[model samples]
Target: MTVGSRRGQATESLRQLTEAVRTESSDGARLVANIADNPICRVTVDTGIPCVVLAWGSYATSAQLRFVHECALDLLRRHALHKILGDDSALAVIPVDDQGWLREDWFPRALEAGLKAAASKCPNGFFGKQSVANVMSGAPVGITVRSFEQLDEAKAWLQTVKI
Candidate 1:
């Protein structure tokens, strides 16, 4: 695909993947924790970069965060992988309590699970960026971390990691 096409695809993919964030049911916010939408976060192994991918679909609650991270950790351990590509372009602001859970709970487990790298396409909004920063600030020391404006750029950096 052409660079422009790739960019367009990335944009459209993020939009579709995050559609759950824009609509709501009687239990709208609860979707972030359970399955109100078909998908709120997608975790999978992407062999192109030889890394696990964690793509968020909305502002996840602590429970949802746990589920996604556990999925990623399982992939990391099972495949002996150390990299993660996070698609956060449409991610909403993560709450402070959930942010703490990420740092205090998830990172340690992921590190023990053998994760060594994380790269994310950050969100455009101020609150979103701040929330990303909040979680990254508490990242464990061994894992490398980087942020990008585009998915391809993040993938390029991951390619250079020698993993």
Candidate 2:
């Protein structure tokens, strides 16, 4: 099959997976968006707070990274979120190429789109820590970035952010 056909098939598969995992409000959080397949990330709006929760899967490719960014951007546009709680504890490795794109391109766009504060739960291993470090180092001004080992702490910190 051609590359375009392969891409189309992949997209369809992701759509199906997203649909399978999609859920509405549960325990006060509302599902806003999700991207499945390679990266498998979901965005949910906290009904009790002005924050968005981003949960990432274990493995991710460059395409998945782009899709995650797109989904996050859409969520930002739809909700007036003051903080983002990024649960990257499952993320293992991020391709070096994708790292640069995230720092240089996606993050700037997110900041411009009104992302104010972000708290992330990072994986414990070297690769995951390094990936988070790279993105944190390159993050633009005006947004606060913090790393946490526990999801509860991350959420608590996000609550303290003024926006």
Least well predicted 10-residue stretch by lDDT in candidate 1: 29-38
Model 1 stretches astray by more than 4 angstroms:
1-37
Q: How would you encode candidate 1's per-residue C-alpha lDDT over 61-107 as one tens digit per residue?
A: 55555555655776788899999999887678888888897899779
C-alpha displacement of 71 in model 1, angstroms? 1.1
Q: Which residue pairs clash in candidate 1?
A: none
Per-prediction TM-score, please?
0.74, 0.74
Candidate 2 on 70-106: residue-level lDDT in tens?
Answer: 5676577678565678888887878888889888987
Local distance difference test, each candidate: 0.75, 0.70
Q: Where is model 2 poorest over a 10-residue stretch in terms of lDDT?
A: 23-32
